[model samples]
Target: MECDASTIVSGFVEKVVSRYAESIDRDNVAPPEFFRDAAGHGVFGLPIPREYGGWGLPFSDFMDALRLIARESPSIAHIIFVHSMSAYFVEKFGSEEAREEILPGAARGERILALAFTEPGAGSDLASIETRAEKRGDTYVLEGEKLFTTNALYADTFIVLARTGPLEARHKALTLFALDKAEGVEVGEPLDLMGFRGTGLARVLLKGVEVPSSRVLGRENEGFKPAVVGLGVGRLPFASIALGIAEGALEEAVRWALERKSFGRPIFENQAVSFPLAEVAAEVEAVKALIRRTAELHDKGENILLHASIAKFLAARLAVKATRIAVQVMGGRGLLTASKVSRLYRDAKAAEIAEGTNEVQLMIIARDLAKRVR
Candidate 1:
């Protein structure tokens, strides 16, 4: 049976997230206690195994929880997505020793995980990563820099992708290491982002950071696991977050249209205001259905690449559209920096770029379609 996460979601939102969300965005930083409080509510452990000190809920439930959190603060939800996705990688592919060492702390949110995948030269083209990990004895010395690493400021560990073989090997040359933030690991100052502001997004400099071969996730030289497995599983949950943003924006728009009167009657009564919101509402519902279906396919071990891409693509676009409409409906109030609708608009724009860009998603979908004819 699928566990419903609503109760936990409600409690966490009311007690821990609701009040501080605006401040977190305004300050462009979430307090340390916010994460701890989320941990206390089992927010971090929802999808981890019970044996690893997690609730072990289905992937769908975890996504549901994330969606609820996103409705209030997409920044916090983005943090959770990065942290949880990294944990998911470890739990699904890490060695027993690595799992035992990392999962428990991660499940408790005591040890935050940052995914160090993108580099200055390699964003969508992950196979072009230049980070090199030279094997020596039983350890590998890593030297590279990762950019836009979410959760970098608070990460206790980094799941880094580096080249382990010849450049000609391409995807086969890659390897993933669970490297601790020890000596030689430097996190740069967080970038001032237009949206998803409080996620601690920063660059990481790895200079001769050494770790045991045992720290390698999956087999050596197969770090493309993220592109093949990690992203397949990840896109749906990301779609769910976009869904939440759209839902939240749509709700705010409806409420504003109903309350804000223009020329006597409520603005909602006018077709001009209602039409756009209604269209956005329909698209939001469609995205929700797509996300749910993709999540179900994920849990069943089905091929979710195309479905996940389509869902993410549509949902992200919906988030942007919905937030734009919400802002339009609210007029000047929505433009204010302090307005929640304004904040959602900024975040929705970012959603289109994160979790794989809209263009990337279209490429995936198009390639999948092309494969059918051959």
Candidate 2:
């Protein structure tokens, strides 16, 4: 990492993040100023290359900042995820014209981007996607809807994954496009979600939306894994997010346990309360270890699909378990809307469903394992 972590945390996290996390979470919208300041500080491009006006941290180091941001405001962390992922995708797969147009401006916080991949009928089954972009002369016209498109409300650019060939073509027919919500595009209302609400989660409608032909990402009709897998997004990004949520919840539960007194003694002294918290803390450490290992493998340029799945799979479940424990430890305070644990619990539940469901991750892992077995 080029910039110091302590300084960013002091200036950004302590000064801005700590102050705004609650209000943003409550309102379900991160203010534009937050993005401006964060981008100015290079928080938006931690993993992006320096040539693109980013800090250019390795993936491992980027995880540290993501974890810190998540600990304070998971909703904002979600925003960071979308921003960094979109930037990285463009830097890796976008055409020179598209990259030059978007990345530099993105680092300046003047541009925001999101990936529109998941659909109402297509979550784990990316092949079933119905969104399509038909080519006509110099422009590609898009007509479809994207569900759970985070950051759509405020994003200036969107990298849409659409089907460009017959449905029977499956992965071979998939294509990636870089489009702007400049015209013929409609953004739905922000979802009142259980968690990650403030990150502008919403549905996007495209009715004959036109994008210049120069914006096509990667090669046409060959969008299987080449377009995204090389970036190591699902493994490190989602796993680190899970780690941050778990750590945040654990911190809250620990603080409450040690501070509140019961029966003229600290409630934390009770083995019943303390043991579970300890277990969650241990689980957090284990998840961190796994995430770090996967990150190291990623930096080494190893094929980390297996490691990523392992990390993403384990960390996701860990978030759910740790948050539930945190809420239980806080007792009645956890149930109150005013309590941070309440929000953490909700966020943790959302983690399991994001990226891919736990069952889907397991299938990937199990398939690989079975193939390698003697």
Candidate 3:
């Protein structure tokens, strides 16, 4: 039976959204209690199978949950999104032993996982990563540094991609390892970035980290395929998060516009103000539709790489525009740190950078289009 996306998860998400938003900004870290609450409520395991103690809900329901979380705290949503995406990868591709060992705890919110893909030498070019993993008996000795790893500080395990074969092989040479944060795994100091501050992004240094054979995800040298597939599915949640940020900014802008007076009249009454607000509203709705459609395409098992990239790119771009307009609408108060629009503005930029940058997405789309023409 298909899960009821709208009905089942909305209420739970609404109850926690505002609280998460407030604490996430104040703490500058994902509120540990919030994740525990979500896990207890079956949100962390939204996509995991019931056998693994997850709800195993349909992808639509997962999107709804993500939207709610994003509305409240985009950083928390982002952290959860990355971890859940990793969990999904493990559940889908990892061996039975791996699944049984990790899935239940992760689904229950007892564990957090991070994706370690971006390297100092390679950002958009995954094939250019210089991180190496050499087989040493039954274990792989890993050595490399991964940058911009979301949730690295909090993650108990990481899905690390390293070059397992000759560098010339590029995509075919890479392999994935489900590495634990043990002695050799060094999580660098948390980065203080301009946005998504609570996500705990950090540089991960893997120096001779020994991962057992059982820790390998999928077969050796076949990591790129699953990594790409996981990224495609992951983009939908990011698009939803962007939509939520834009919507939140819009709501704040409207509230401020209606209440704040200029020239002895409410600012919203001005055609100049109202027209831009209307434009933002329309753009937000369009983004929502795009995110939903892309998610549906993913659920249908269609090849949605181009569509995912499009949705992610457009949603991120629109979010930046909408949030900027929101700030403009609110004038001085919008620039204040305490203002909702202000936070939204910061969060909106992350959408453009995470999952994949807008530039990278455009390149992917253009490449796909060129192939079709050929």
Candidate 4:
């Protein structure tokens, strides 16, 4: 049975995430208690199936929940999104034994997960990853450094991508593994980020970490497929986060416009203020429609590469635009670092960069259009 989205969203998310968003940003760390509390509320298991100890909600339901959480705290929303995405990968492609072993704990938030796909040299290009996994009898020895690993400090399990073949093989040489933190796995201190803070983002060093053959995710040397599939499916939720940012920014702007008076009248009475807010209000609905439709396609087991890209692309850009307008409406007050509008403004840029950049999304769209016309 599906968990009640309203209950979870209203009761826990608003009370906790909204209350702590500023402190989370100011301290640049989401306390462990935050995650534990979320676990107690089933926030981590919104999309996983009931048999796996999750709520078994649909993708759209999860997105609705994500949007609300992001509106309160984008950092928390992003953290949950990455964690849930890893759980999705495991349940979708992992072996039955692996699922039985990992999913229940992950669903319960007992085992936090991270994606270790990016390297210092391999950012957008997954084929050039320099990490190596050498086979030795029944175990594989992994040695590589993963960069920009979200949840690096807190993740009990990592979904890692390494090269099992020569670099000349390109994407074919890559492999995926589900690795638990061990003696050789070292996590660096969290990096100071401009936005999406408090996520425990850090670099992970794997110095000859060993894993059993059973830990391999999907097939060896064919990991690129599952990686691509997981990333593609992840874009829609990413879009939902951006939608939340836009919604939050707009809300702040509307409040400021209504309250801040200029020359004895509320600033909202001015056409300059009202028109932009009105336009963004309409745009927000458009983005919600797009995300809802894309999420519906995903629930039907349809390919969402192009549609997800569109949703992410538009939503991220709209977030930046909406935040900018909010800040402008607040005038100098919005510039204060402590202001919610300012924080939202800073956080909005990360949406465009993560889940693939706006340029990458455009390229994907262009490539799809090119193929369709031929």
RMSD of each: 1.5, 1.6, 1.9, 1.0
For every model shown, what is its TM-score relative to the native structure? 0.97, 0.96, 0.94, 0.98
After superposition, the stretches of candidate 2 with alpha carbons farther than 4 Å from their true spots are 227-232
Higher-scoring candidate on TM-score, 3 or 4: 4
Residues 189-262, model 2: lDDT tens digits: 99989888688888999888998878888888866675448333555777788889899999999899999899
TM-score of 1: 0.97
Weakest ten-residue segment in model 2 by summed lDDT: 226-235
Ranking by lDDT: 4, 1, 3, 2
lDDT of 1 by residue, 1-374 (tens): 34358888889888987977898888888788888788888877778888999788777787788888888889888888888899988987799999999999998899988899999999988888999999999999999899999999989989999999988888889998999897468999988999999898999999899899889998888779664579766888888888889988989999999999889999999999999999998887777777777787778878888888898899899899989999999999999999999999999999999878999999998898899987
Which portions of model 3 miss their true places by more than 4 Å?
1-15
The candidate scoring highest on lDDT is 4
Better model by lDDT: candidate 3 vs candidate 4: 4
For model 1, name the residue pairs that clash: none
**Clashing residue pair totals per candidate (backbone < 3 A):** 0, 1, 0, 0
